[model samples]
Target chain A: MKARVTVTLKPGVLDPQGAAIAQALGGLGFTGVQGVRQGKLIEIDLAEGDAATARAEVEAMCEKLLANTVIETYAVEIA
Target chain B: MKARVTVTLKPGVLDPQGAAIAQALGGLGFTGVQGVRQGKLIEIDLAEGDAATARAEVEAMCEKLLANTVIETYAVEIA
Candidate 1:
């Protein structure tokens, strides 16, 4: 099985990295770039298993290491 | 309408940011943490509209600014 985890900053959080990227892009001549926010995507290959079990393990991974709960939120998908 | 765009590093991409985070977590006394990959989630609240159009717009957004297409891929869901 393969799973993907995405983690992002919550709304209202200031994303300095994102802002900087937007500026860089604009300077690179990519215009009309209004706002930019940067986040992360994680893809994991797991032992073949059921969706329920995969969900459980992925949740543990997120809580344990994949995410910084203080500033981000995460969602998981298994395929 | 609300749409979520999830972007992740393709496998084999070296994630220095994630590695640094793992190290910091270990220093903070978190044990048994093996690997970490970071990604991003983008949530957009759009004008009430059609799902198909929302998808198109979000796709353009990802291409234009939200992601560094050089190393990342993105998926969008409209809800």
Candidate 2:
């Protein structure tokens, strides 16, 4: 099974990297861009085949390592 | 309107960050882990409402600034 974890900043949190990207886009003359927020996309290849088990395991991974719970939130998808 | 751009390293590209994550997971006693690949997920808030135009513009942004086409690939999703 394959799992994907998307870790994103929580609402109301400041994202400097995302801000920089927005600014850079403006500099590059790409208008109409009001805001930009950046996050992480982690694709994991697992030996486990059961969908439910994989989702649970990946979620555990997120809570333990993949996401900083105070400032970031994570969502896991299994395929 | 909102758009999302997912940028990932090409298949043949080496990802040290991903390797480190996999190793750390192993160290943490999480077994059955095969591999991990890390990528970027960018969310952009646009003033434009038209889906087609937004997609086109986001793709242009990806080509010109968001992705380093030489080693990475990017997909834009408008919502």
Candidate 3:
């Protein structure tokens, strides 16, 4: 099984990297952009297991290591 | 409307951030974790528009600024 974990900065968090990109975009004439924030995506290829258990484990991983809860939130997708 | 762009490091790209996290996990005794790679996710809240055009614009954003195509690939989800 494979899971994709997407971690993103919360709406109020400051994203310096994204700010830089937004500035760069305006400089490049992609002016429609209003705001941008950046975060993370982690893909995990897991061994076969019960779906509920797998989700728990992955969520633990995200909370423990993949994302900093103070500034980011994560969502997972399975396939 | 909103769209999410998930950008991840290609398999061969060196991910210092992920390596650092993996090492930290190992230090904390997450023994089964053999490897890790980190990437970026951007959530874009766009004005209501045509889905096809929104996707194209987002792809352009990813290729132009949201991701470094040299080392990453992106997937988009809309809602």
Candidate 4:
């Protein structure tokens, strides 16, 4: 089984890296870019299991260490 | 309009960061974790435009600066 966890900054959280990226894009002539937010994607390969179980396991992983709950949010996908 | 670019290490590339994450998970007692790969998610907010246009623009951004084409691959999503 494979599970993917997408971890993103929570709304209203300041993202300095994202700001830097947006500024870089503007400097490079990509003028239409308004804002940018950066996040993480973690792909985990697991032992054989159903989607439901895999999702639960990954979500637990997210809560424990994959995400910084105070300023970040996470979503899990299984395949 | 919003677009997302997912940048990941290419197959066969060594990912020390990912290895470190897996090891950290093991230390934290997430026993079922077999393999782990890490990537980046970049979200861009743009002026009103069609999804196709937004996707194309983001793809260009990925190719130019978001991804290291030699060792990374990227996918774009628009909403």
- Reported per model, the fraction of native interface contacts reproduced equals 0.28, 0.93, 0.38, 0.89
Question: A1-79, model 2: which lDDT tens digit per residue?
Answer: 9998999999999999999999999999988999999999999999999999999999999999999999999999998
- Sorted on DockQ, best first, the list reads 2, 4, 3, 1
Best model number under lDDT: 2
Per-model clash counts, in order, read 8, 0, 0, 0
- The alpha-carbon deviation from the true structure for residue A52 of candidate 2, after best TM-score superposition, in angstroms, is 0.4
lDDT of 1 by residue, B1-79 (tens): 7777887787789988868766765666544446666677665666647889778877877898777899988889888
CA displacement after TM-score superposition, residue A17 of candidate 4 (Å):
0.5
Ranking according to TM-score, highest score first: 2, 4, 3, 1
Ranking by lDDT: 2, 4, 3, 1
- Best model per TM-score: 2
Which regions of candidate 3 fall more than 4 Å away from where they truly are?
Answer: none
Model 3 per-residue lDDT tens digits across residues B1-79: 5778888888888888878877876777555455666777777766547888878877888888777888888888876
Clashing residue pairs for model 3 = none
TM-score of chain B of each: 0.87, 0.97, 0.91, 0.94
Error of model 1, residue B8, in angstroms: 6.1
lDDT at residue A69 of model 1 (Cα atoms): 88
TM per prediction: 0.59, 0.99, 0.82, 0.96
CAPRI-style quality class for the chain A–B interface of candidate 2: high
DockQ of each: 0.26, 0.94, 0.48, 0.84
DockQ of 1: 0.26
List candidate 1 segments past 4 Å from native. Answer: B1-79
